[model samples]
Target chain A: MRRWLAAHWRAFSATLARFAGAPLTSLLNVTVIGTALALPLGFYLVLSNLQGLARDYSPQPQVSIFLNIDAQEADVREITQRLKSQPGIAGFRFVPRDQALKSLQSRTGLGDVIAGLGQNPLPDAFVVDAGRKATALESLRAEFARWPKVAEVHVDSDWARRLDSLLALGRYAVLMLASALALALVAITFNTIRLQILTQRDEIEVAKLIGATDGYIQRPFLYLGSLIGCTGGAVAWLMVWGALWVFNGQLRPLAELYGIPLTLAHLNGSDSMATLLFAGGLGWFGAWLSVRRHLHHYNPS
Target chain B: MTQIVLSGVHKRYPGGHEALANISLAINAGELVFVTGHSGAGKSTLLKLIAAIERPSTGSVIVNGQNIGTLRARGIPFLRRHLGLVFQDHKLLFDRSVIDNVLLPLDINGFDRREGTRRARAALDKVGLLHKEKAQPITLSGGEQQRLCIARAIVHRPAILLADEPTGNLDADYATEIGVLFRDFNQVGVTVVLATHDMQLAARLNPRLIEVRAGRLAA
Candidate 1:
């Protein structure tokens, strides 16, 4: 094992020199891979933060139920007590018709028309606030629908449903984009490794000729490919952070629109580790596939 | 007893072209042998079979007490370690220096770096190019590069040496020098097989000749 490691080190050092031997080509290949990886990473950052904002600023649901004008004061008190007792129901507001008419008259420039003919024409109404998710308001809507004195059930935050759908669609789009870019990244690395293999074909075949095991011959290239991939993944992570930094100013107002206090999330420790391992695994697999294909076709005999 | 034996070894490509036909021969240890024929004959094929680079389509080949015809993929590398081989083009890694080239076989055979380098340098000394150890193979003349390849082949001290027209790429002067170098190695008890159609070098070496014609041994 010691001897194998010694030989492997020499092999690795030799391959490193050879890889860095062509400086311009190596740089170009790595940059191409890094850029391919960055697109999805950047999009995912934006999409993830948007989803977070959607969750953080989600409004509390409120339902307004207009009561029958003929309903007595005792009925209103009974409804209030019932609304408070239900699970996930914070409370309700009861507005008498006289108070409602008075506000309307003052705001609509009809305040002094013989004091609105000495009678309030508006119906009494109540406001219901949901204590939890917007879905929790559905029971209130149903209760209002079943009420004999209620005219309508109006949920103020129902439009948030459309926003939820949009956020979900955005997530799917980002995932699709990320997957496509990852494929492009794999191809870029594979093609670069393929070209490198082509140039080293003679040496590789000669190695086989001289009794180098397939694994022994494959070790250095696997390291080379993984180094390139993990380096690209590191660059992708940097691009993700850089893009978020540049867009931090714009994101604040967007957060304000939803009354959310959302912050940008760069690749975390888990993501960085995942990226490094993914890049290394991707590179190793690509090179292994390439070498296997070549060895099958390569006839040193 | 014969150290290298082939009994009715036949190799046919999947496309149905026969590379060798019923080849049966015996070579004693320490004997210098020449596999000679026109182009397209089975000389190279025979060498490949013995090295386990390719298996026989039919029959068996036994070399150094092992049946090479049945050797699997993993066994191929092991088979190559017991023999040193050279090619018509010299097949040297041009990116490496002369000493790096010589140290390659020993490196594969699992020698320590110091010992591998020491043996590689000594092998270069044998080929009379100890001073050129640091020079890139491309920097050397065709003759010097071929000598470097020979040094690399013998560096691990394998008991058998296989050459497929080792001097074919060199000029007459270099070719003659290479021929003399092989003669000296043969004198030192390395079983040598020189596969060549260069009738003149064959006559000079005066080795036991095994001729092939159209994939069959021609007496």
Candidate 2:
């Protein structure tokens, strides 16, 4: 076990030396891989932040049930009781006709005109917070419209439904993009290892001739690939973080326009760890493939 | 005891060229034998067959009691670990320091780092190249590089040592020096098999000689 660990440590250090030997090339390759990975990762972050904003700020799907102008206090109380009993209704608030009239008068700055009319033009209304599903909210609106003394029911959840669908589509897009870029990462590592094998052909042949096992010969290359992958993953994480920081600065004005606090969340610890491991695994696989294909060709003869 | 044996061995390359045909030979433990032949007399093929680098086209080539013809790919490295090989081209890693070239086989075999370095230095000292241990192989002269190859091969202290044209590019002094080195190792009971066309070196060493001509043994 000690020897095994030493051998692996040697391979790892050898890989690091190789990177140090060719810093510019290693850096360029890592940059290319990191940039490619950052595209999907950035999009994913954006979609996640958008979903979070939608969750935090988007109002619940509400159905406003307006009563007839002749609706009495008894009718209002009866409808309130019915709404409370509705299974799908999350909650409801009652606005009496007089309260509604006063609100409109203050909001519109038409207090004198409303007072001159000698009557409250606005009807009593019940705003019901229903679940966010468009179909469920529409059905509830229709049911509320059928209630006695209810003149109309309005569903204000169309824009919310559209935003939800857009976010779902964005999530799918991020997934597909991530899948394609992951393949690109693997291919990049594969080609890099292939070139490394070719350049070290003499060293490999000599090592094999000296009784190096297949595992011994391939360890350094595998380490090289995985190191590149892991470094690239770290680079991608940094790129995403830097981009989010810049984008958040730009989004502050838009968030103020909507009068809501908005900021994109950086990759959590688990997500950052997953990215590094995923990249390292892909790199290891690529190196394995390249070595399996090429190492046999250098038999000591 | 027989350390290597060949019975009815034949080797044919991909282009239908026969490198060796109907050859049979054996060398006992601790024997220093020279394979003498012209440039294309299949001397290297004989060494390669003994080393398990190439299998016989027909019949068996056995080393250390294991038949080379039936050795698995995975078993080849283990077989080779017990044998030291010197190629005609030296096969030294020019990118590494001289000591590193000697340390490779030990590294491959997973010897402890400090122990491997000690052995590597001892091997280099034996070849009189200890002072040049830090220099790159490419900086060495032809004879020095050949010595480096020998140091690398013998660093693991294998039971059998095989050399292909070890003195092919050396001067008379260097060639005699190498021949003496082989004799010294053989005296210490390491079986040595060397292939060469240099009859002068062969005559000077006066060890057992097997001559080959046109892919067949010359009796």
Candidate 3:
């Protein structure tokens, strides 16, 4: 076990020195990979924020039943009782004709115009809260619309449903974009690793001639690929966070216009770790494939 | 006490080119032997066969009690670990400093870093290139570069040393120096096999000479 650790340490340090040997080339490779990775990750962050804001700000669907203007007060009482008994109905509040007109006058500042009319124009109503998703409440609104003595039924917040569908489509597009960028990252790593193997061909041949095993010859290149990948992942993380910082400056005023306290989330700890690990794994795999293809062509003889 | 024993060894490459044919020879431990031949006369092939870099087509090559012809692919590195093999060209990594080139064999063996550095320096000193340890191989003279290759080859202190034209590209003075270095190592009980086409240099060294003509050993 001790020997294994020592061997790995040696290989690691040696590979690190080789990378440090050519800093500009390594930096160029890493920058390209980082930029490729950042596009998908940035889109994901935007989609997540959109989903979050939609959840917090979009009002719930409310089913409102309006009684006939000539219906007796008893009909309003009966409808309220019926809504209370409904299984899915969470709660209901009754608004009489006079009370509705009074509140509308106060809210809209049309009290004098209402007094000049000399009669209440609003009908008695019950606002029912279904306390369920839009789909379930939609059916409740439909049923109430068909009830006797109901002059009209309005389902508030229908715009929430439209926004939900639009957001779902956006999420799907982001997922597709993420997949395409991931494939691009793999191909980039593959090409870089292939070039590295070619440049080190003479070193590998000499090592093999002097009794170095295939594993020994391969270790440094594998480490080179992984270092590039992990550093690229770190660069992507920096890019996303920096973008959010700059974008949040513009987002605050827009969020204020809608009266929602919005703050976009950065990647959580586990998410960041996963990103780094995933990038490093791709790099290791690319290096493994490149080395396997070329090592067969080299023999000590 | 025989270090290498080849019996009826033959090597036939694909496309029907036979490089060695029904050759049998033996060299005892601590013996300095020379394989002298014309180009394509199988001198290099015989050394490669003993190094286990190429397997014989039809016979046994026993080196230090292991049958080279029957060794598995995974066992080749281990066989080479006990033998020091040198090439004629492309022997040094010009990108690395001389000491680093010598440290390669020790590095592959996973030797302790401090101890490996010490051994690498000692090997460089043995080749009388200690003052040039930090120089890149391209900056060294041809003889210095070949000596660096020898340093890298024997850094791990292998029991057998095989050189394929170690002095082929050097002047006579440098060639004599490298030949003397081989003689010095052989005096200390290391089996040395030097292959070359330079008959004059071979006569000067006056080692146990074996001649090859065509694909067979000549008497």
Q: lDDT of model 3 at residue B52?
A: 88
Angstrom error at residue A226, model 2: 1.4
lDDT of 3 by residue, A241-291 (tens): 999998888889998998877778888999999999988888787788778
Which candidate wins on lDDT?
Answer: 2
Which candidate number has the best DockQ? 2
lDDT of 3: 0.85
When sorted by TM-score, best at the front, the candidate numbers are 2, 3, 1
Worst 10 residues of 3 chain A by lDDT: A52-61
Clashing pairs in 1: none
lDDT of 3 by residue, B142-178 (tens): 8888898898888899999999999899888998999
Of models 1 and 2, which has the larger TM-score? 2
lDDT of 1 by residue, A19-130 (tens): 6898888677677777777887777777677676666666677888887778888878767776677667777787788888878887988887738478776788887777
> Each candidate's DockQ score against the native complex?
0.63, 0.81, 0.60
Per-residue lDDT tens digits for candidate 2, residues A95-149, read: 8888888888989999999999987788899888887566898779778878999
Q: TM-score for each prediction?
A: 0.81, 0.93, 0.88
